[model samples]
Target: MYSIFGVAWFSDPRKLFALVRQRLNLGGVFVFSQPPGSLGAYGLQGMYKGGFAGPAMYTYRFSYTHAMWRSLLLSAGLRRSRDLLHEAPKPDHIGTSDCPSRVPE
Candidate 1:
């Protein structure tokens, strides 16, 4: 099993995916949780709304939407599997605080 956490946001995801695919044992699982709309596609849309830009958008590289991510995994030879996942809280519904006070670690 592997958990890539936040590193994929700033690096070459294709390279990362290739490395992970090479290193994993048969049937090994790879998992990660990215904040909603972190891709350049989404970030550009959100930029007009004054939302923060994620690393993917900042560098103008290594970006993916949910669909793109799925396709990428498949192209990397990873099988798609059903798993329970939660949707991120919508910005308008996340209480009165719209911005974080500190950068996430």
Candidate 2:
């Protein structure tokens, strides 16, 4: 195969890590997507602006910045590759709320 590697829901990447541990083959690379930044005021601010962050909000969305993901991957025997962070775009504006921020991503 060209690449036995794969990407699972890094959303809860640790889950994927476990799967990868059982499924991945030699030379396989597991790629996953992630959001950047830590969960906190800034992160919460961004979320408030971005809109629709869902109840499963994270402190950070950066690429694989999760210690859990790292631990799971390592525990499952997957090598850590470069994390990729993707910032969801903020809403153009809020729907007439004085929240000072727009929709969350």
Worst 10 residues of 2 by lDDT: 96-105
Name the TM-score of candidate 2: 0.41
Model 2 ranges off by over 4 Å: 1-12, 37-64, 85-105
- Model 1, range 5-94, lDDT digits (tens) per residue? 354544466666667677777777766554445424542222222246654442333445656666666677665464334544775431
TM-score of each: 0.56, 0.41
CA displacement after TM-score superposition, residue 77 of candidate 1 (Å): 1.2
Candidate 1: the clashing residue pairs are: none
- Output the lDDT of residue 28, model 1: 71
lDDT of predicted model 1: 0.49
Highest-scoring model, lDDT: 1
Which candidate tops TM-score?
Answer: 1
Q: CA lDDT of each candidate? A: 0.49, 0.40
Q: Please report, as a residue range, the 10-residue window in candidate 1 with the lowest summed lDDT.
A: 95-104
